[model samples]
Target chain A: MTKTKKDVKLQQPKNQKYAGKAMTKGRYIRSQMKRNWVGYVMVAPFLIMFIAFTVVPVVLSILLSFTSFNMLQVPEWKGLDNYVQLFLADDLFITAFSNTMLFAITTGPASFILAFIVAWFINELSPRLRAFVTLIFYAPSISGTAYLVWGIFFKGDIYGYVNGWLLKMGMISEPIVFFKDVNYIVPLCIVVAIWTSLGTTFLSNIAGLQGVDRSLYEAGAIDGVKNRWQEAWYITLPSMRSILLFGAVLAITGAFGFGAIVDNLCGNPSTDYVAWTLQHHLVEYMGTRFEYGYASAIAVVLFAIMMGANALVQKFLSKVGE
Target chain B: MAVKKLRVRGHRVVLNRSKGGDVGITVMLILLGALMFLPMWYLLIESVKPLGERNITPPLLYVMKPTAQNFIDLFSNINSTWVPISRYFFNTIIISVAATFGCLVFGSLTAYALSKIKFPGRVAMFKMIQWSLMISSTITGITNFFIFIWLDWLNTYWISIIPVWASTLGLYLMKQFIDANISDEMIEAARIDGAGELRIYWQIVMPLVKPAWLTLLVTTFQQVWNAGASGYVWSEQLKTFNSAIATISGVSAGAASAGSVVMMSVPIIIFIINQSKIVETMASSGMKD
Candidate 1:
C-alpha cells in the first residue's frame, strides 16, 4: 500500500501535465461512473419498464397515426387522410370539437379558481377543521363512481329529483329531459365536471398554501400591504409558483380530456353530441370502430392542444409577480 | 408570560376587526362543504332505501325505513352468469395493492438515484422522464393495447400493474422531498463507515423519507383504486371493481349505490387514517418562499 501510494503521488503531476486539459471531463465522468454504479442499478428496473410501456407506446402511437390500420388488417399508408377527414368531413367530429371547447373553457378556469379559493379558505382554519373540510370537498372527485349518482338526480323522467321537484312546485307542466335534451346536456354535464374537478389540484393548492412561509405575511404587512388580497397577490402567488404551475397543467389537461364525466352523466354519443369530447371520439373509433389510425390521429391532436396549453400556462405563470 | 401577554394584546386590534369576517367565512365554508357532500350523502341514503320507497314520486331526503337489502342483494343476488361480487372485490384489492407497492418501491428507487447519486447521464435521464409526462396515457392508449397483446399481457393482472410501475408524479415528488429533507452530512458519514451504497439507501435514506413515501402511497393507492374501466382487460373473471360498478349500475340504481359504497370505502378509510401524514408531506416538499 505504501509503495503504491508513493508511486501514485510521483506519477500524478506528470499525468496531469500530459493529459489534464483533454481528459478532465472524460475522467470526471469515468470516475463518477466507477463510484456511482449503484445508482444505475437502482434505477434500472423502473427505467426498463417505463421505456417498454410508456416510451415505446408513445412512439408507436405517433407512427400509427399516419397509417390506416383497422385491427383486423394490415396498416396501409394514409398520409394525412385521417386528419383531413377529422377536420373537414366528419360532422360528428366537428360537433365533438365544439362541445369539447365549450366544456373545457367553462370548467377549466372555473375549477382552477374555485380550487385555489377553497384551498386558501381552508388554510386559514384550524388544522383539524381544515383537514375535515378538505376531505369533504375532495371526496367526490376520488370516489370513482360517486358522481354517477347525478344521473339519477338529473334523470329525464318524473322520478328524477330535479324534474320531480320542479313539477311538484308548479314550475313547469312537463318534465325536462335533462340528459336527453340538447339544451340541458351541456350545462348539466358542465355542472358535474365542476363538481368532480375539486380533486388533486385542490389538494396540491392546499399543500402549497400551507408551505408558504408565515413570516412573509408579517413582512408584507410591515412593507405596507394592508389587506388579504394584497398579501395573497404579492406573497402567496410568487412563493408557490411551481405548485401553481402544476395545478394549471393538471386543470388544463383534465378539462381537455373531460370525457368520463360526460360519458357517465350523459350518455356516450350524447344527445346530438352535446357533451361529446375528443376523448369520446377517440374511444369511439378505437374501442367500438377498431379504427386505430383515426384514434391515433385524434390523440396527436389532443397532444398538440395540451402542449400548446401548457406553454401558454408557463408564459402566464412567468408574468405572475410582475 | 408578561411579554407573551403584551404580544397577544398587540394583535387584539387586528383580531377584533376580523371577528365578524371570520364567522361569515366559516358559515360560507360550511355551506359549501354541505353542497360538496350532498351527492355522497344522497348515495348513502339511496342505497339504504328499499326498492319500494326508491320510486316515491319525490325522493325522500331521509330514508323512512333504512334496510341493508341492497347490500345483501349485492353479494347474494345471482342473476348474472359472470363472476361473483366477491371475486370482483378480490381482484380489485389485489391489483390495487400490487400496483401501489410496485410504484412506491421502484419510483422511490429511481427518484433517489436522480436526486442524490451523481452519475453520467443523470440529467438526460431526468429530462426524459419529465418529457414523458407531456405524452400522457390517453395518447398511448391504443398502442399500449397492441403492445400488451404482443407481450401476452392482455387479460392479465400484469397488464394493469406493470404499465404503472414507474410513476412520473411519484418520482418528481420524491426528488423534491429528498432534496429538501435529506442531509448530506449523514450520508457522507454513513459512507465513511464503509456502508455499501445500497445499504445506506435502504437503512438511512428510506427511513428518513417516510413522509414522502407515505404521500406516494396515498396517491398511488387512490389512483389504482379509482382507475376507470379500460379496454385492456377483457375477461369477465379479470374485470376490476370499476367494471363491476358499471355492470351493477347497469342492473339497478340501488345495486350501483351499494357497489360504489363498497368500492370507495377502502381508499377513504386509508386516507382518513393517514390524513395528517399526506398533508404534512405535501407541506414539507419545499414549495416555500
Candidate 2:
C-alpha cells in the first residue's frame, strides 16, 4: 500500500497529496496524520456516532447471542444454547426462517429483475416522461403507508377493490380474507413486498441506466450488436457492474427486512405466522419475548444469511456479461 | 458532456432495433407501471373520496365528489388526542430536521476528509463502513436497545433522533460523490490560499457537492419523517406525526386513509423536487467492493 502510494506521489510530485520527508512508512503515516489532524477532527463526530450505533451494536449482538440476558438481569453465558434452541428446540424460529428464506428468494430476485428490466425499458423515453415513470414506479417504496393501500385493496369485504371486482366479474361468491387467509397471506405479502421493493435498488438502477455512456452503444453498433437485449447483456450490465452490485446489496438488505410491510398489511404475527420473517422474529424476541440472547441468536443467523447472500450475489454479479 | 460534437437528443441508436420490440417494451413498461401504480392511485382516490363514497360497492376507482373533509376530520381527531396534535408535529419536525441536518453536516465533514485528505486510518475506517453496509440495522435491534438504555436515552427524543444521525448510508453516498466530482488539487489550492479546512469544507467543497448533501438530506428526512412506533419513546407527547396518525387511523377509516396520504405526500414531493440531484448523487453510488 505504502509503495504504490509513494510511487504515485513520485510520478506526480506536482500536486503531492502526501509529501513525506523520506521517512519510514509508519513515520510517514504519523507525519501525515499530524499534518491532517483536522481530517480526524472532521471525521470524529460521525465515526463516534457510527461506531456507537452501527459497529458497537453488531459486536454486542454477537457477544450477547452466546449469553442469556434480559434487560433487568446480568447476561449469563451459555455458549451455543441459543443456536441449539433456535435450530433444534424452537419450531417458530424454523417457521420464521423458512418464511424469511421464502420471502428473500422470491422478493429479492423479483425486485432486482423488475427494477432492472423496468429501468431499461423506460430508459429510452424523453427525460420528462422518464422521471414521471420513475415517480410512478419508485413512489410506493418511499411512501411510508403506501403499501397499506394493498390492505384496503385486499380488505376482506365486498367493498374491497379486489373482492368488489371479483364479485362484479362473478369470479368468487364472497370476498376472500386476503390478509388473514393462510393461503393468500404469503402470495399477498410477496406482491405487496414487491410493490414496495422498488426502493434504493430501483433508484440506483435507474440512475445507473441513465449514467451508462452513450458511446458504449455507438461502439456496440459498430461491433454489430443486434438488439437491445444483446446491448444490455454485453455493454450496459458490464459497464454498470458496480451499480449492479450496489443494487444487489440493497436488494438483499431490503428482502430480509420485510417485517414492517407484513406487519402493516397483514398484522404482526400474521395469521398462523404465514408471513413471519426473521425481522419480525428478531423484534418479537427482543421486545415481547425479552429473550435478548435468543433474539441476538436470531439476529446472528439473519446477519449470516444476509451477508452470505450478499457474498453470493457479488460472486454471481461478477459473472454478468461473461 | 464533453461538448465535442453537436448531437441530437437520445443519441446512440442501437443496431437493428425493431419496432415490434419497441412496442413490446412500451407495453410492458405501461402494464407494469400501471400495476405498480394502481394501489397508490387507489390511496389518493380514497383520500379524496367523501365518507359516503368511501364505502361504495367495489369502491369507485375515481371519486364522484372530492372533499377535504377527511383531512379536516383527521386533523380534528389529531387535535383531540391525549397530547396536543402540535406536540406530535413538533416531535416529528424536530427529530427529522435535527437528524437530517446532523447527518448531512457530520457525514459530509467525514466525506470531505476521506475523499480529499490523505490521513492515516482513513482506509480502514471506510472499509469498516463498507462492510457495515452488508448488515442491515435490523440485525442490531437488540443491541441498539441496550445501548439506548446504557446511554440513558430510552423514552427520550434523543433515542429516536441520535441513532439516525449515524447512518452510514448518507456518509457513504456523500464520500462517493465527493470522490467522483471533487479533486484533490482543488482542496490543495484552497489550503495554499490560506483557507482553513473548515472554511474550505463549508464554502468550497459543500457548495460544489450540493447534490450529494441534498440527496442525503432528502433521503434522511424521508426516513425520519415516516418513523412510527419507536420502542424508545413511550410518552404520547414525544411521538411523531406518523405515530399520531396511526392512533387517528383507529377511529375513522376515511381519516386514516387521509392521514396516510398526508404522511406519504411529504417524502414523495421532496423526492420529486430533488429527483435530478438525487439521481446525480446516485450515479456515483456504485463502489467496486
Candidate 3:
C-alpha cells in the first residue's frame, strides 16, 4: 500500500508541472498582446497617415516620372523622354540648377557662421539676457510678418526704406534697383535668407554650445590655453561638433529646398542669372502647364542633388563626430 | 610666503578683468540684434502711415501723422471678398487651433509611450521620426495633395490639420524631454496602483511634459497659421491672408506693393506680441541634442 501511494504522488507532481508550464505560457502571450495592443492602436493613426500621404506619394512620384501625364490627360508611359528633355533641352533646368547651387553655397555657409556667432553671444550672457536676445532673433523666423516688413525695406525706389536709408547715409547717390536688377536679386535674397535662417538652428547651436563639458574648458585652461579663441577651437568646437553638423545640414537643405520666398519675391520669368531652378520649373510645369511627367523628372533630379548634398553632410558630420 | 600670496592675488585680478575680445563680442551682438530688428521696425512704422505718406523718400522712421486707414482698408477689403475676410480669419483660427492641439495631444501621447512603454519596434519608430525630420515638406507636398484629393477631403480642414498633426519634430522634442525628465519608476508605480495607460498619461506624463507641449503648441501654431500650400489647395473659398495678398498683388506691380505691405504687417504684429515666447521655445529646442 505504501509503494502504490508513493508512485501516485510522483505521477501527480509530474502532471502538475506540465499544466503549470502551459498556463504561464498562455498568460504571457495574453498579457503581452493586451499591453501592446493599445500601443499599436495609438501609433496606427500616424502610421496610416504617413503611409497614405508621404510613402505613397514618393512611390507614385517615381512612377509618374516615367509617364507623360498632364492633369488633363491620363499618364502615358513615355519611358526616358521626360528625363531626356529635362537634361538635354531644358535651359531653365540648367539655369535653376546653377541658381540653386549658388544660393546653397553662399547662403548655407554664411547663415551657419552668422548663427554660430549669434548663438555664442547669446549663450555667454546671463540667463535672463540670453532668453531675451534669443527671442529677438528667433521671432522673425516663426512670424510670417518679417517678410512683409522686409518687403518695404527692400523696395527698389527711394521710397523704399533700405534705399532711403542708404541715400541718407550717402552710401549711394540714387536708389539701388534691388529687385529689378539681376545682379542684386540673388544677394538680396541671400540677405533675407540669412535673416530668417535664425530660426530653431540658432537656438540649437546655443544649446549645443551649452552642453559642452566644463571640464574640457577647465582642462584646456590648465594646459595654458590663454584666450577664448583657443578655448573655442580646442574644446567648444570639438564638443559641439554634432550640433554644428546638424545645424549645417539644416542650413544646406533649407537653402537648396528654398522655393516660396524666391517664388514670391522674384516672380516667374526669372529675371537674370540662373534664378529659374528645378523647383521653379517643376512648379511651373505642374501647376501652370499641368505637365506632371516633366515636373516629376525635374523633381527627381532635384531630389538626387539634395540626397547627394545630404550624404556629403552626413559624411562630414561623422568625421567631425569622431 | 607674503610675496607668493601677493603674486597669486595679482594673477586673479588680471583674470577677472574684461578682455578686449569680450568687448568686441558685446558690440557685435548688439549690432546683429539691431540689424535683425530693423526690418520689422520699418514695417510697423509704415503700416500706420497714410497711403500718400507711404511713398516718402527715405521712408519715415516715425509716422508724423499716424493713421488707421491701412487697417481699415484691409478690414473693408477683406469684408468685400466673395468669401468674407471673416471666414478666412475663422478658418485660419480653426485650422491653426486644431493643428496645434492635435500635435500637443498626439505628440505628447506618442512621446510618453515611446519613453515609458518598453515594446518591440519603439526604437524603429523613433528612428523613423528622425528620418522624417531630415526630409523637406516640398518632397511630400504633391503627394499629400493627391492623397487629400483621393479621399475627397480636398478643401476641408482635415487636409490641413491631419498632415501637420504628425509633426516629426514635435514628436522628437517630446521624446527628448520625456527621456531627460520623466522617471520610469513613477510610471510603473502608477500602473501598479491600477492606473490605466491613458490615465497615467493624462495625470502624470502630461503635467511633466507641459513645457515641451507648450513649445510644440507654439511652434505648430506658427507653422499652421502661416501654412501656404494646403491653404491654397483645399479651400479656394477660404483664402489665407498670404493667398489673398498674393492674388491682389500678383495682378500688377503697383497692387503687389500695397498688397505686400498689408499682407506682411499682419504677421509682424503677431510676432511682436509673441516674440518672447517664440525665442524661448526656439532656444530651448535648439539647445537640445
Candidate 4:
C-alpha cells in the first residue's frame, strides 16, 4: 500500500538537476521537512495510531497468512501450504468462496444501481421533501440491528409475520422456514441486504446528483437534449463520475461484508453450510479454533477478491456515460 | 394540464419529463420506499405490543392495548440488574464520545495538513490512508487481538475506543471535503497575517470545515455507538449498551424488541437533525481518482 508513491518520489534525480549533485533524495526530503515540519506534527497523532492499529495489522495478517501460528508457539514459516490447503484441500473453503462470490456478485451491483436509480428519482424533489424520502430508504440500513427485525418478520415458525399471514389467508399449511431453508436463506438475506444497502452510497449518489450544476442541464436542454433520459445520460452521470466510483467502493465493501447478517439471522456455520461464507470461515479458524495460519489464509483470499472486484468495477465505472 | 410547457424549477429547465414517466417513477419510489420502511415500522409496533399481542397467530399490526409495559418490563428484566441499567448507556456514551472526538480532531488536522500544506509526502500519506479503505477491517481481526494483548489493552475501554479512532473512514471524507471546499488562498492569507499553523487551524480552517467535522462526528459516533463484544473487554462494567442489549435479547424477547427500537432511534434521530448538513458534507466527499 505504501510502496508505489515512495518509489516514484525517490527516483527524483530531477532534484539533482535543479540543486546540484548535493541534492540527494534524503536531503531534498529534509529540506521539505524543514519547511513543513508543522504539517508532520499536526498529522502525527492520527498517523501514529492509524499505523499501529490499522496498517501494521493488515501487513502482519498478510505476512502471517504465509506462516503457521496456533497461538501456542512462535509463528513458523509455511510457504504456500496454507493457500494450497485452502484452495485445493479444504472443502469448506470452496463452499465459502463460492457462496461469498454469489452473495457479493448479487448484492453489490444490485445495490449500487438501486442506490443510483432511487437517488436519481428523488433528486427532483425539493430539498425538504428529498431529505425525508431519502431517510425512508436510508434509515433501514443505518438503524443498527434494526435489520434483525427481518428475523421476527420472517421467523421460521407459523407465528412469523409471513407465516402467520399465509396461514390466516389459507395460502399455506405450515410456516415456511425463511432463514433456515437453504433455498430461502440466500435469497431472503440478499433481499434484506439490498434493503439496508441503500445507505452511505445512496446518500452520496443523491448528493452527487444534486451537486451536478443546474446550469449544465440548462445548457444541455438548449443544445437539443430532448428528454429527462438524455439529460441524465449527457449531463448527470458523467458529471458525478468520481462520486459514482466512491459509491461503488462502498457497495463492494458492504456486499463482501455480508456475513454478520447471515450469522445473526441464520446461525453461523449455517445449516448444511449453505449460508456459510468466508467471513464465518475466518471466525471459525481465527476466533474459535485459534488456528491463525488458516484464518489468515481465508482473510487474505477474501481481501484479494474484494480488491479485485473493486478494480474491475472501477474499470467498468470509468465507462459510465460513454 | 400544460403537457407540452417548458417547466423550470427555480433556474434549471426540468427537461422533457413525460407525465406517465413522472407518475411511474414516483409510484416505483413509493412502492420500494414502503418495502424499505415496513420492517422498521413493524419492529416499532412489536416493541410496543403487549405480551399477549406479541404471540398472536397473525400478530396485531396496531397495538390494541397500548402501554409502556413492554418498555418497563424490558428495563426490569435485564440481567444482573444490580449494575443499574443506566450504566450500560454510560459506558457507551463515554466510549463513543471520546473515540469520536479524538477521531474528529486527529482526522481534521491530518486532513488539513494533507489538503492545504506543502509537505513532501503529503500526497503519498493521504493515498496510503485512502487505500486503507479498499480492504475490510475484519481481515485485521486476528492481528488486532494479539496487538490488544501486547498493548495490555485487553479487558479495558481502550480496547473499544482506540480501534475506532484508528479507522480511516472519517479521514478519507474529511480530506476530500477539505480539498474541494477549503481554498489555498485563504490559508495563505491567514499565514500572511502572521498566523502560525496551529493558530490558523484553530481559527481559520476549523471554522471553515464545520460541516465536514459534523459529518465526521455523526458518522464516527454512529459506528462506535454500535460497538459490541470484541472478544476483548470482558469486564462487565466496561461492556457497552450493545453487548448488554445483545445479552438481553437472548433472555427476554420483549426487552430485545425495545432494545432494537432504542438502538435504531439514536442514529436515526441524529441523522434527521443533521440530514441537510450531511448532504452538504457529502457534496464535497467526491474523489477525483
Index of the highest-TM-score prediction? 4
In the range A167-276, model 3's lDDT, one tens digit per residue, is 99999998877766788777877788888887656756655565554556656665666678777766777676656655766787688886666665666664764366
lDDT of 2 by residue, A97-205 (tens): 9999999999999999998898888888776777799899988888677788888888999989899999999999988988889999999888888988887666666
lDDT measured at residue B194 in model 2 versus the true structure, 0 to 100: 64
Error of 4 at B152 (Å): 0.6
Compose the digit string of candidate 1's lDDT tens values, residues B1-289. Answer: 2222112345532311256666777888888888888888888887887988978876777798899988877765544637876787788888988998999888888888887788899899988876666666778888988888899987788987887786676776666556655766666666656678778778877766665577568767888888846567788888776777666655667877887887778787887777787656545544321
Model 4 docking category: acceptable
TM-score of structure candidate 2: 0.88
Provide interface RMSD per model, one decimal.
5.9, 5.4, 9.3, 6.6
Stretches off by above 4 angstroms in model 1 are: A1-23, A215-225, B1-17, B78-86, B179-211, B228-230, B245-251, B279-289
Model 3 clash tally, residue pairs: 10
Preferred candidate (DockQ higher): 1 or 2:
2
Clashes of each: 0, 0, 10, 0
Best candidate according to lDDT: 2
User: By TM-score, how accurate is candidate 4?
Assistant: 0.88
lDDT (Cα atoms) of all candidates against the true structure: 0.78, 0.81, 0.68, 0.80
- Candidate 3 per-residue lDDT over residues B16-98, each given as its tens digit: 11478889989988998998887766656665677677667777778788776665565556545677666666777777778
